[model samples]
Target: MTALFDVILPVFLVVGFGYLVCWRKWLTEVAVDGVMRFAQNFALPVLLFSAIARLDLGANYNPLLLLAFYCGAILSFLLGVALARYWLKRPIEDAIAIGFVCLFSNSLLLGVPITERAYGAEALVGNFTIISIHSPLLYTFGITAMEFARAQGQNLPLGRVALRALSGVLHTPLVIGILCGFAMNLMGLAGLVMPDGFWAAVTMMSSAALPAALFGLGGILYRYRPEGEMRAIALCCFGSLLLHPAVTFGLGKLFALSIAEMRSAVVTAAMPPGVNAYLFAALYGVAKRVSASAVLVATGLSILTVWFWLGALP
Candidate 1:
């Protein structure tokens, strides 16, 4: 327990600091955006690239582990669509966004740092696998589905939709990092260490990603309030915090993954919706408020839910 606290406390403390500063209005939107943009476009990719470059892929990597969490993702997408359309009575566009909120997790910002703390850098082999493909699988599916729905009433080209979805995956920074890392791994650059000065710079940039992301979370969260159709928002939160992880755990059991692998799968699935979902909603003008509200709600509640998982997991 004490050991767990030692790991969990620092992570949330950074998150708390970000929230506090935002609440106090010390970090303005411009500053927050700058920090977040830099982290996403540069800092996070470097962090991921470095982490992946160093990974001893032979013994640590497990391709099968992705099945557990992605099983949850698939179900969440279908559930989001069904609930939004039937239960919530929202438009197909809104339903697609709702499904997206349920599908995407805050894997990059929260998952990476927390998992590093709880499971060490080695455990990240499985963690990175999910992170690498998380956006592509979920976003591509969501985007293509939404586009297809639009096509039902019009003559949108299938080729164009496929290209757009492929573009989304290609432009993602985490995916870029994962590709670069894999390249390094294949090129036998994993063991190659940079000189002290350059290494220091890489390490500094990598370390900056977590705090910047948390601070960005704190600042961005204030933009959302519990407005609009909140029942749908509540559903999104429920799926994110509970159903997502629960489904993953069941799948892990089915796959007969190691206890540690099971723990990682569950914990990663348990993360709240990433801001990217809200960004996606806003970009396409589909359930923007619902997506933002879901991110805020799930993130606020996750402080407790994440703690419980950390303590519960062996």
Candidate 2:
């Protein structure tokens, strides 16, 4: 279908290219690590700041739509936790990881680019707003879940853990970028002009971020496979591909969104599991197996899911 060609095919191309590079040893773990570090540290921050700084905070933004999106994410996360705990009977740590995989989508790298392609630049403001809120949830609640799992046999300083988690959220580059953008917007000082040369340089660097992040993701996926964790991975893929998007579509109607806003919300909900889920899992010593599996399954499944959603869009 035309939708498959336009929206889904491009994602596969990027991911497939990375897979080939990794398979051929063109990108090693070291190279992937370096690229990821660069993305997290520099390129992503620049992209976020630039996008948010230019956005008009006073514009006709729909707060209710944003609220609905967050509610959907929270419910999805809870559902994932319940399924993992009761149905799968997974260990506490693994359940937490599974819940995160089901809920925490790659909204920054994959979501932004895909939504822009589907809905255009105006939708980015809403998309970024969602990311800003969602990032903290992924970092804090996700980490706490893992900690709870890890501390099952031992004791943990719950108060200290909460404070540390909050600190981590405050210090994250993405959070910092969002804060700076908000401050700039609030002060109405983002209108300060930059030289053409400066603008060109930032544009060049910002452009490289998306492709590099995608390629890094592809390489990571190439290096890892779900292997024996197929069942857990399948559940996550289904949640991301089917359940989350369906809920988002239903909620969008309740919000009385315009066609474009509804499309943006649906596409965002359909995004694959986020790279951050893996990072948090690894950091917290939780279900590393499921985390790795999630990356592989989510990336592969997104091709079909995105195609279907785009096709059904009016």
Candidate 3:
């Protein structure tokens, strides 16, 4: 109850507020899109850049932790694809979009803040470690898979398909921001090159990333009805809320990860599908309904699911 009220409810309150405002017609769809655009293209990217720039890669980049967490993520993706393709009778492209939804957890907006609230700021190093490469790695994998799925049966050369996919991934603002952060970190130019004022301004913008995105997500979600994808949405919710974290928890135990690492990995894995899931679906024009409904339903379900996981965790 404490976790439900203290940790999860506060987050949903913001989402609910957005939904209420949109329901009352106070915020138009275009306005919501503008907010999302600001968050996705600018503020969130700045947040990622700042987080990765100052990330202590040497101390927190635990290979075992990453291995445990990502193994679960990949398994969920594969399961989502398989179940959607075989059981749900969705097309290959739709299956891939569903898989992407299951694969891409809300690591940033939900995971980081939830972990911070549940544990503490001091415990966020593991969350940060996972997040540092979360977008880049998952986006790459999802895009590559999607491209390959789209390329099936076409005479398009494999190299061209690969290049096209690569181009799409590279052109994303989030990916660009992550790459820039990595370059800065690797080249040791974080503090040395950028002026303090620049960093401060980044700090200011980055702070709005989560709240604004969450609010925008609520409004955007209002546009997507669950409709005919009940089974698919249930599968997505199951994979994201239960299967992913179960795999992560088992792997973490096998790896003997510390309490903090286990907490971070499982909690992150338990988050609902992010807005990117719907964005990916919308971008590819496949399974948009399922993706969006899953985002909405899973996010609502996560209010309870995350509370359970928090109790189940050490």
Highest lDDT against the true fold, candidate: 3
Instruction: Give the whole-model CA lDDT for all candidates, comma-separated.
Output: 0.81, 0.76, 0.88
Pairs of residues clashing in candidate 3: none
> Tens-digit lDDT track for model 3 on 1-314?
88988888888888888788888999888898999899889988888888787777787899999999899999999999999999999999999999988999999888977898899878888887888778778887888898888888887888887787788878888878887877778767434577789889998998899899888878877777776579999989999999999999999999999999999999999999998998999999999889999998999899989999999999
Q: How much is the lDDT of residue 292 in candidate 1?
A: 92
* Tens-digit per-residue lDDT, 219-279, candidate 1: 7777778777889998898888888898988878788888778767888998999999898
Compute the lDDT of residue 137 as modeled in candidate 3.
Answer: 85
lDDT of 3 at 280: 91
Provide the global lDDT of candidate 3 against the true structure.
0.88
- What TM-scores do the predictions have? 0.91, 0.90, 0.95
Alpha-carbon shift of residue 298 in model 2 (angstroms):
1.8
Query: What order do you get sorting by TM-score, best first?
Result: 3, 1, 2
Cα lDDT tens digits for candidate 2, 1-314: 76677766786688688778888998688988888778877788778777776676656367876766666666677777788888888877767777888788788888888877776777676777667667766677777666666666677778866777788888888878777766756655635665779658778878888888887777778867766567777888877777888888888888887777677677888888877777777876767778788778888878888888777666
Model 3 collision count:
0
Supply candidate 3's per-residue lDDT for 17.
83
After aligning candidate 1 to the native by TM-score, how far in Å is the CA of 211 from where it should be?
1.4
